[model samples]
Target: MNSNFSLPNQKSKAILERYASSMSTSNAVSFPMVISHGEGCWLTDVDGNKYLDMMAGIAVNTTGYAHPAVVKAVQEQAAKVQHLCFAVFASEPQVALAERLKKHVGQDYRVFFGNSGTEGIEAAMKLARYHTKRPYFIAFTGSFHGRSMGALSLTASVSKYRKGFGNLVPGVFHAPYPQPYKYPRTAEMVLEHLEFLFKHTTPPEEVAGIFVEPIQGEGGYIVPPAGFMQDLRSICDKHGILLVADEVQTGVGRTGQFLASEFDNVQPDIVVLAKGLASGYPISAVMFKEHISTWGAGAHGTTFGGNPVSSAAALATLDILENGAMENARVQGEYLLGRMRALQARVPQLGDVRGRGLMIGLEFVKDPVSKLEHPELRDRVQQLGLEHGLILLGAGSHAIRLAPPLVLTTEDAKYAADTLEKIILEAASH
Candidate 1:
């Protein structure tokens, strides 16, 4: 073998061995190739292999990598003032970003800035507890809130995530959510379970908030049936419990809309956003209705939550998402989902294809009759994409998630569909 051809791949392996953690992390179905650079919807590996990125850093990049407007805004903001520590000195960028986010939330809403989705969830939890003077919360099973203790307490997606983390935050109760593909339960049944929970388990009077994902992200990207959120909202209102939407993955135009909750006409009492808010910058927003403003000063504070540079990037990201990226999502998502539906009819392993906008999920099963989840096949299909210079991620038990950048074009959609078809067909044969 020629040494030149092997050099690039070997260098990546070497760097990973030397600097990266040894613990095996198999979340992304990550390929061995080291990324050299990224543009709109593509990433080039160190070995010069170009991959169409369908994961979009797990629905974080709203405007794509190194977007000109976002980059320029970040550069200019950094030159002016990178760190004003919003707690100490009021930052113009922070205030401007808050003003922009305000319109998206609603007229009578308040914004709390943080650095990640989990932090936002934490804030929402605190605010709910403080405002309601309640000690309990209701979180849906098969949901991924975050990894921190407080948020993790609300997360019930995978048992492995909470296996050994004993002494997990208490005061959190889990209720089943509707999953058509995996479970036989319907929205009505889930609502009944909530009713049972309120009666038998934790009393609604003691519950502060009910946390939910507008479109469940890690739990197979499952989107509950119509009227689910509406029913849940009514229940929350009836009990004086806050309805909290964990929009960390579905917010910021990932679902072809500003918020996935918007589609159901269900207004959440609190909205937690992060992933696409600043493209790739670390920023999370916890927006709540104005009525929950019982929080006083010194209750919560972060030193670097509202960094000026990140705020500028967020402002730029919103500009792009509103101007063009959102419409692209609205159009291209339909095209991609249509192709996937056609493919689903032809492929036996493809058990289900469902999602809204760009946040699609392609679920795999062992066979049509059994309908048993084929997680192995799902992993193989993901690996096949990586081997063929395509980037994608797996979610839940046996589903591949497609959450490409909002800027994905029709051409990109065609390429993704074609590539997925090729990959799935080849895997099926094996």
Candidate 2:
């Protein structure tokens, strides 16, 4: 650890001042460190202070920072052609990526590329409504789809995200997401609530799609009870509603499986993937089953959605994932989970430690008995993490998320576990 280091050193401070003057205030700043560059699972600030990166650009860096293969692919693609709008012209890289996605999905799903997860969600919304001719949709409380008007309506993770953005898209209703840690038989409870919604509020026939996160990302990294997704699939099948999996955070082998939904053996009607698709490059894919691709060409298109360079990078990323990075995520994830759970046993304030594969969450509470959230302690842990040369981020209300790059090794995972244990101990004492 860099004992002499402090955040926002002179160089970082200067850059931050310039950023403050130039950038929009709406942009949320989680940490003060000004990064110089990153490699593997580590980042260095402008002041030359090194920090172990656990968040991985909010779970976007699948192959870690500037992996050689991804860089070479990007360079080669850029040398050939940067951008030739896929809407007007066919590109080899884009078509190849689409084919790869289809193969990986193991389904006859058609792909639609977009610039962000929100755009993918927006496209899914349009396709769902267009195909079903339905005006209503169902999402869950504490879910975050995105910020666009259509996606925002389905986003209920944070109230502030929707505050003042009134008159959101109509016909979107929310159901309670099951958190087994807090409430037992939460799957049954949520299913009962959905049934109630169908009976009292929204008609089953009018609902277009059911938007869900396989493992609710922003919602405290909450993992639902077993069979919850399978139950949802059955419900969707019964109601003629499309099941849309928002894999923006949990997709691309983050949760051991290529798709977290695979854990439950459920295949969603629509799947939206982004974040780690191109290892931080701007690209998202909204895939729907072949039967659901009812929209005609030109109905929805993006000029730069599937840029050649990004597609090449994605192909390289997929190669790495297929070869070994993905399996590394599984092994290291289990190792980290065991380390944290052991620590949890000794720490009273560490309320619950839950996750699947590399996508994990450590929830803090005032006490384990009551399990009351300790947001202040969570905040302290995140802040102190910076001083300890560990980069961290919080998810939901009182949980710290561990979403490091898929390239993380067992040794690095040990470093993260040890450092986080120290941070948690200090934070809990305070």
Minimum summed lDDT over a 10-residue window in model 2 is located at 1-10
lDDT of 2 by residue, 177-206 (tens): 998876665798899999999999999999
Off by over 4 Å in 2: 1-8
RMSD of each: 3.2, 2.5
Q: lDDT per prediction? A: 0.88, 0.91
Shift in Å, residue 333, candidate 2:
0.3
In model 1, the runs with Cα more than 4 Å from the true position are: 1-8, 20-29
What lDDT tens digits, residue by residue, belong to model 1 across residues 1-430? 1111122477667655644455445443255666788998999876678889998989998887889999999999999989977678888888898889888778788888999999999999999999999999999999999999999999999998898897898999999979987776899999999989888989999999999998899998898998889998999989999999999999988988898999999889999999999999999999888888888987988988978999999999999988988888889889988988998888888989999889999999988778899988887888788777778788898899999999997888898999999999888778
Per-residue lDDT value at 148 in model 1: 92
Kindly give the stretch of ten consecutive residues in candidate 1 with the minimal lDDT sum. 1-10
Clashing pairs in 2: none
The TM-score obtained by model 1 is 0.96
